[model samples]
Target chain A: MTNKHNPAALNTGRRPLRGAGINLFYLPAILILIVFTVWPLLSGIQLSFTNWDGYSPTKAFVGLSNYLTMFKDHNFGTVLVNTLIYGVGSTAIQQVIGLGLALLLNSRIKGRNIMRAIIYLPALVSAVIMGTMYYFVFQYQQGALNTLMVSLGLPRVVWFDKPAVSVAIIVIINSLQYVGTSMIIYLAGLQGMDHSVIEAADLDGAHGWKKFRNITLPLLMPAFSTSVVLNLIGGLKLFDVIQVLTGGGPGYSTNSVSTYIGLTYFSNQNAGYASAMGVVLFVIIAIATTLLNKGLDRLGWES
Target chain B: MTSAIRHAEAASRSTDTTGKGNGKGGRRIGHALAYLFLGAMIVAQLLPFWLALSAASKPSTDMSSTLVPRLHDIAWDNFTTAITQGGILTAVGNSVIVTVCSTVLVCICGAAAAYPLARRKTRGNKLVSAGIMSLMMVPPLSILVPLYTLMVNTGGVNTRWGIVLVTVAGNLPLAIFLYTAFIKAVPESIDEAGMIDGASRFMIFIRLILPLLKPVTATVVIMTSVGVWNEYALSNYLISDPGKQLIAPRVASFFAMQSSNLGVGAASALIAALPIVIVYLFLQRYFIAGIAAGAEK
Candidate 1:
């Protein structure tokens, strides 16, 4: 396996025909990334330092003023808290529901295929569309839930009026819509599990809850990590759903950092401040992702 | 990322279930509980769509509860209004154009970039690979200020190519990662054999390596199209023109305008969702695979 002439080693290493000139193949992608991603990221940092209105030609250096303003902005604190809620809150719901569904459906049950398909279907639709459809349930007037409430002789409550309720609805919608993602990942984890290990546990009198707790759950750690990271990032970047459902409204009460950036830059014309929010968002996500990966690596027993 | 691809591949092949016996009474209770949970979830998952369908099929004058089905006299007019007044059809067209262009660009650029990193494996190429992969973590909205500024200054905003370029960049990292992993698994002998036949490196990549990338390319195409089609954060701002807006933003704006006409709003939302739903029904496996690959990012 260590020999250079072995095809496996050769395939992973620098091969004979794969010369330096071939590096040109990646130049276009690298260029696109540089111009579109890397450059904007750098410029975002630069823009954060100046008080430049988004469209204006002239600007003055603001030093740390934009970043400093965040400390004093009450709405900024709420938005930050909402962002964490969306991220951690959605991740929690998705994992619980997703794994529960995966555990139930990973069997010889009738309609399991259709169940899986239907469960995962929402993940395929645009979140904006999902959010709009979900509005039928939460609409103040003639909403489905309200109709149900009225039929039961209860009061029809306005769902999005309160900040807490609006935030919870956002989290629930996001989690339900993409919980299928985590479900499928866990299903795959279940499918890829070494059956022999499970059978051995069975032979050793491990069954049902005991088996799942001691064996199945631990075995699913890789999938758990993958799903958690994906869900967390997706939830943190919660934009489309919030945009459609609440529009981060009721006085910016439900704005994730992502949506708040939009509100500040577009509506408020605070591009410099928005750029600082963007920088904060980038740092938060980068740090969160790295920490999760590291922490999950330590937690995963199979590796 | 490779783990996702591997897991999906494994999932597609294995249908084995952990249905080993437990204590009889406990097992029966567990099964009952599972069934109860599954039924509840099914209803919960489908309820919104059901409500939307009911609303979409009714006229604004039909103030019936959304929980009830519009069994008879279903108003097709709502969907028609969605197309006519909501501009959903045009938005769909714009989404298609952007999605197709971005997906194709991502496939080409991703596969091409992957060849060197997977085959050549120079220190610089490895570094480049790591850097590109890292870009996947940068949420698009985080770069919104500068990216939008750059697009405006470059006259890139509101143009089809503008959205296309931005989406291609956004999607390229995952595409490249998927491609690189796939290409690495391809034996080096294939490229060596091409070289022995006097093919240039580019020729070998195109003539030999490219053909072998079909499976992974399917994954990339499926993932990129879904992503680019559903994209909102950047697309909403970069292409604010009504005619140029993608489906997500277009639907959001339409929903906003139709607040007084909830039926029309529901119709527009359903219309926007229809294409992806149809595609998902037909290609469920690929969508699952796309999730697996996308989950890695």
Candidate 2:
């Protein structure tokens, strides 16, 4: 029945279904994107220059005042720094731990499948819930840590008393929750590797650490980039965990730009300033993503 | 492949023959250390959930360490209270509606969008594709203020369809990227065959391409469902009404209100996490594969 369709045999040839009409298939998606994402993004930029208090209909054009105010705002500086720390700290830690776990599980370990499942479990759970669960370890009253301290006849230590300590806890929790993502990525990369190359290197007296550094490490570059970028973006946009754990408390000391924006808009009612901060966050992520991609591409080329 | 394995086995055998005596003790110590490290990591990873379980089972008056489990006096009321007072079931229902609606829209729109982009490489289509892909990098919070305003003006705030549209838009970029990649791999000859059969482009897409999209659709569905189900940033503000709020925001708010009642808080958190955990356990293979595929984009 299929052979009966020989219309193309008489003609020179028919190209692979090329037409302007088919482009309409993307219309629905493009319309949704335009309305929901692109339009909002553009309007956010426009709102950055206004002095709207998020509720009032009337607004005055404030020019670059919002952007200028952001520069002088000491709290914004702290939030920006925290954002970077969360992004870089989590990315670095996740790579080390994720790769280590992946390597360990890849080896001939007992019950590795279960281990993999367990390690990856939290990555699937909502970060808000994970943060609440982890709060048990650091909660002030009857916390796991405080309970142990009292049992050992020590003073009750406040876990989130200081800003730095709180920030560090957030980083660790975020990293631990999502390290499974990186581990799975690297595991896939390792499994898909050209084992023949490893075998050849092995035949040439390359063993263990030497083999891993020269052969395996370079081969895992693609996975490294994917995991790093994903983790980095996730960390930079860290919201739920911080919201649940501290709610950007301690006088905004632990706020990332994300949490700061929410506070500014909802709590502070500084919609214009929050919009400016949103623009800044977007620009920062854009620059970071571009620079990291370029750097990774160079590394890939060199290796 | 067989020969590669044979060579790998032979290579290991040779390494064993040459370095057996010198490295035997060191290898044993290394294995032991590896196991120790992994065991400790396993504990660290499981500690939170274990403690949550313990806390949920204990009474609110039990201010003992969450590390301690109540073997005899289990607080059954905590779970019931979370379900009844915490509005967890309502939140779960809200999440289900939003997640299902968003996932379906994403899969349909994404697959439809990818067909033309993958088939026709027109300059306009290429630019459109790039533009759509770039939206993936625009963090949702970055556009929250204006999006919230838009939702309010349009009466989309506190509505299930509103949240669904926003989530679908947020997730469609990645879904379209994945679907486009998958469809590009599918032989163009298939489309040509449909064309030769005098089938319309839509007919070819509906009849031929859609069936082959099953695997990628699974990846998209899993990704979008998990994302929308657990979404906090957008949904937190967009659906501020308690009845319409999704799981993450609802649970967070409930936990905050019940902060003193650790038992109820723990129960609510566990209830929110249970559905995803059960799904993951049952479809462990697909979850891992879906995430891996998502990351590849």
Candidate 3:
């Protein structure tokens, strides 16, 4: 089996038709992608400029009116602000906690694997389930938190009743569920580090926070970017937990782009407006991810 | 100097130049503190799930009065009511079907699309790869409005097959990206060796490549299936039928029931998540690998 052709044999000008089987391998996925993923993306842009209610067979073009209304809608304003806060806030919490866990776990520790798995447990449940479980935890009256607080002679507070607090709560819940992912990524990065360098640092008489600041974090930038992008995008698109927990309630203050888009499209009976909002949401995510990744790349290069 | 060495140097500078015994004792204390902090956090994290589980076991009426109803207050009726009254059985069945179908198809299609793109250096394939790459970056939400309308128009709404196709389509990019990276590591000699045996490319893919893809497949399968299983927005918006919908939305209806009885609702929610959680427990190694691999791209 090995004698006939070396790996060097395949790519030498005979690569154009590596095996006429290329189409067979590519077509099924490409076809499905075109129909489901590509088509809607193309059409969605066109739909956003119109006033097409979902039920209407014909979409009368409104030429940026939908976009205009989306920008001006006070509810949209709050949703946009909430989306930013959620994305930034959740990413911040997850990063700090995740990196701390990674650094701690990387050191010699007992029950490390168990701790990692336990932290990741919350992530296994769906957002709706987490939100529901937490609904019990945050109930103003008989809620777990309130019960504990009262038992400790502290004041009991309603968690989701206030719009701003609900927004903050949404970010906290997202961070709690997802921080494990960042930890795992960072741990992988830590494990991949060249240990010889650490030994050299030890020989150089350096240790502790100085070692981490000068060495570990920079090398882990790729993992850091991955974690940030994932958390940021996830935070931006947050829906299920916020939906279940607050339903964008105390008014639309807790709504991120996802839940707002759902509400607009389904209940508001305004597909065009929803499409416009979706497009805007898409733009925000695209721009933020690009900027964040680029900024990180530059930072790594500059350092 | 490499940041690695530089940081190492900085670390060495900060350490005490004192005797080894004192350093060892100090390190022990630091290690103990790290353990203590992590232990407390782990407990804090697990407490909510534990509380929910305990609540699920309790009688509905007792849940309201007790912060975490004791196991002694257990009511087997929570499961009975959840299964019987909550329509949990049907929702679970539907979720299983959708998640399985989508995951399998995504794996297959992702493999198919990834192989050529990853291997071929030709201009045409490069262009195609670039297209898929960019498309991968686009948010599925941006296309939600049109996707919903198309699904509706094509009679895809509320259908098992419809959601399956949608889920597969939505998740393909990540799968393809992962598979491509995985495959690139497979030396072309394996394929060339197979080709010398008169095995065609399709045969090589099936007979050779498929088996080798086991690790990435686990990653893809776990990630995609869990994603589809837990999905709420797509299933809810696309499948309006209460009975036909997946567990997320179906479980969502339990919120109303939860207002009255936390036990039954918690029981139902846990039941809905039980399958994925069980899968994660068994395949935790692959689950962690998958998260890392998926993110590395």
Candidate 4:
């Protein structure tokens, strides 16, 4: 309601027809979005109801059949469960580890900058490289891990043979690789905290665990929420690591929805069915993200 | 002001009493434990890179050895063979073209679009912002099939430009969101001053605004480049020609061709990763800042 002049806004008195010209700036962007994003999204929804092999022109419209087929598929069920576990587990691990690292690095440490750089190296590397590196590390015979285990007088475990363990390892590797980003976020939050409040707590004998729990943790909720949402979204959409490391294999144990969709669309050449799966995945993500955003709002994150 | 004085007093008191009793011993033990944990974590993180570097340097025959490679048997030929026989050079070139072009285009278009959204208080601003936000939530696979079909129909499939354009499009929402956030942080006063000096809007953006946005620009460039270079899924489906494939798809195909050449494959993979690793090492601060900004928003 304040009538303060905003220089960015056009002067209506001098430029009465500015609105029409101003609207022109939006055309190129809107056109690109429609062509590249919105149209494809709408087309994908349409394709979900049809029975179209990727190549053939002839198609049959099948309502909800593809969705029904996905429901009945055992692999789909397993993959859904896997995606949830991976999402929750990775988010938890990454947040905790990243928070700890951020706190440690926040304090005075020797060569902190160098350590920060080294820790962040993995995130910058392509998922393919990270997966390949892990593949060698988890190789059955000549793996570095097996060698280390042998030296430590522990049994050489075949990582990929067991489904759950293989999936967990993949999640751990991916989470660790990305922890640096979360750590940086937490570091920023820490930097922005009111230092005076922390000092007051210190004066009241809030030291160590008490100080951390009462002062540090509560103030760091924004970072926690952000990290949690990001890690969850990332975990659900995980593809590159799984693709390179196991190819959704050791018998589809590590398969995610993204990988499944890729296999169905590209390898199986069932575009319509894949589109249906994609829609389902999209709905799930949208719902989860909405819930999270609501929760964050309640926690005053938007402020 | 009182808090600062209190903090100083507390620090002095703590230091004055630091040499008391068995607390020093306890603190030393705690420090040792912290160092021990940190060292182990560092080793865990660095071990893979160490292994890759050592293995790449070792002769092919020595690759299967249980022991770590000796410094003497470093097979420098692996680098040459990786480029020549492994066909990594062409893949590297393809990756460079795709990453560089996509990143530049995304940055330009994203910034241009973001300027209006960030600066103007128009009727559709909120709607536009929400639309872009929702676009970020849409899973990549949801539109993959349709996009592929569209590309094939439009004669965009199997071309470098095709890959670049798609990557740019896919990345637009996030890029615009980040750019809007960054541009908002720059005050409108600068624009007013430029206008008072009789500068055009485009001139103001290019001269005043763009220079100040170097940090965000570096962050976006690094992120987008790494993403484009390492992307396997899009390249796998789009580029059928092996010669035109980027580094990731090339690695996948190379591994498929000769599983026994794990050493060479690993080496080639390392070679592909080196540029990003180098960039990350130099611009790590900006990378972290960009991520922190994105997450915070």
Q: Residue A252 of model 2: what lDDT?
A: 89
Docking class of 3: medium
Span of ten consecutive residues with least summed lDDT in model 1 chain B: B6-15
lDDT of 4 by residue, A79-99 (tens): 888788778888888888788
Q: Rank the candidates by DockQ, best first.
A: 3, 2, 1, 4
Model 2 DockQ reads 0.54
Give the candidate order by descending lDDT.
2, 1, 3, 4
Model number with the top lDDT: 2
Model 3 clashing residue pairs (backbone): A201-B8, A205-B12, A205-B13, A206-B11, A206-B12, A206-B13, A207-B11, A207-B12
**TM-score per model (chain B):** 0.90, 0.92, 0.86, 0.83
Poorest lDDT segment (10 consecutive residues) of candidate 4 chain A? A12-21
Computed on C-alpha atoms, the DockQ of candidate 4 is 0.40
Give the proportion of true interface contacts each model preserves, from 0 to 1.
0.72, 0.69, 0.63, 0.46
Model 2, B191-241: lDDT tens digits are 877877777789999999999999999999999998888899999999888
The candidate that achieves the highest DockQ relative to the unseen native structure: 3
Name every residue pair that clashes in candidate 1.
none
Error of 3 at B267 (Å): 0.8
Candidate 3 residue-wise lDDT, A1-303, digit = tens: 453355455455344336455756888888988998888877888888888888877879999999888767999988999989998999999999899899988777778887888888777678888888777778776678888898899998978778877887788888989889999999999988888777777777655765577677777988898899889988888888887888888878788877888888888888888888888887888789899989999988764
Best of the candidates, TM-score? 2
> Model 3 residue B270 lDDT?
77
Docking class of 2: medium
Candidate 3 to native Cα RMSD, angstroms: 3.4
Ten contiguous residues minimizing lDDT sum, candidate 1 chain A: A1-10
